[model samples]
Target: MIDDKTTPCPFLGEMVVMFCQAYPVRKPVPKHLITASNPCAGKGYKGCPFFKDIMAGLGGATGVDPTLASRDRKGVTS
Candidate 1:
């Protein structure tokens, strides 16, 4: 299996960008709707933009989720 942290990082970055571009409104995506499954298993935590912002808010790297900085601290999977 891929390290959980590394697996989701790229998807999270893309989500961050998508979320920022579509920000100012909250769009709730049902867990089933998301499709980044191979690496993330469609877990909102893996591909959900909200999580990216949350990770960023916790004094992490400005854009990408910091847990992705390595194969550690992947934290909770959606």
Candidate 2:
């Protein structure tokens, strides 16, 4: 949560940075990154670097589908 406001673009001073890798273009909004505490939720996913990256399939370092991850966490197996 780098919401210092002094930070530059791509570093919108949010937790999104911790879950994403930088890209030339903006990133995409990751569903997994969306939480009740996220400030961007109300603002939508426009001009968001992390959101753009996720849309381009370059974001989310979790390496696992969020749905699957949740299921796994619950000990649910296919």
Candidate 3:
């Protein structure tokens, strides 16, 4: 779940919390967000909350990218 390594994700805290709740078995760390091998190893996940949470829980077991489950809204395009 490593982000791009450019900047820290604003949603990192929320994402980690959600991830822990969703997948109590595999508690991911902030390091995962920068490892490139984790499931949600990208950016823009900071926006899509649900998808991001799901991916964190899945932990690469699912090929689902949180960014793709995005829904369009006014001023919001992914």
Error of 1 at 9 (Å): 48
Q: Name the weakest run of 10 consecutive residues (lDDT summed) in model 1.
A: 14-23
How does candidate 1 score on lDDT?
0.45
Of candidates 3 and 2, the better by lDDT:
2
| Sequence-dependent TM-score of model 3 | 0.20
Candidate 2 C-alpha lDDT tens digits along 1-78: 787576679745544332223234335576667776674655553357654555455334545453353233333333
In model 3, which residue pairs have backbone atoms overlapping below 3 Å?
1-33, 1-38, 2-33, 2-34, 3-33
lDDT, residue 40, candidate 3: 51
Candidate 3, residue 36: the lDDT equals 53
Q: What is the C-alpha lDDT profile of model 1 across 15-56, one tens digit per residue?
A: 222222223454444545445753334344546575565556
lDDT of 3: 0.47
Q: Which TM-score value belongs to model 1? A: 0.23
lDDT of 3 by residue, 1-78 (tens): 666888778776544322323332545465535555444554643445555565655564466644453322233343
Q: Which ranges of candidate 3 are over 4 A from the true structure?
A: 1-46, 60-62, 65-78
Q: Report lDDT per candidate.
A: 0.45, 0.48, 0.47
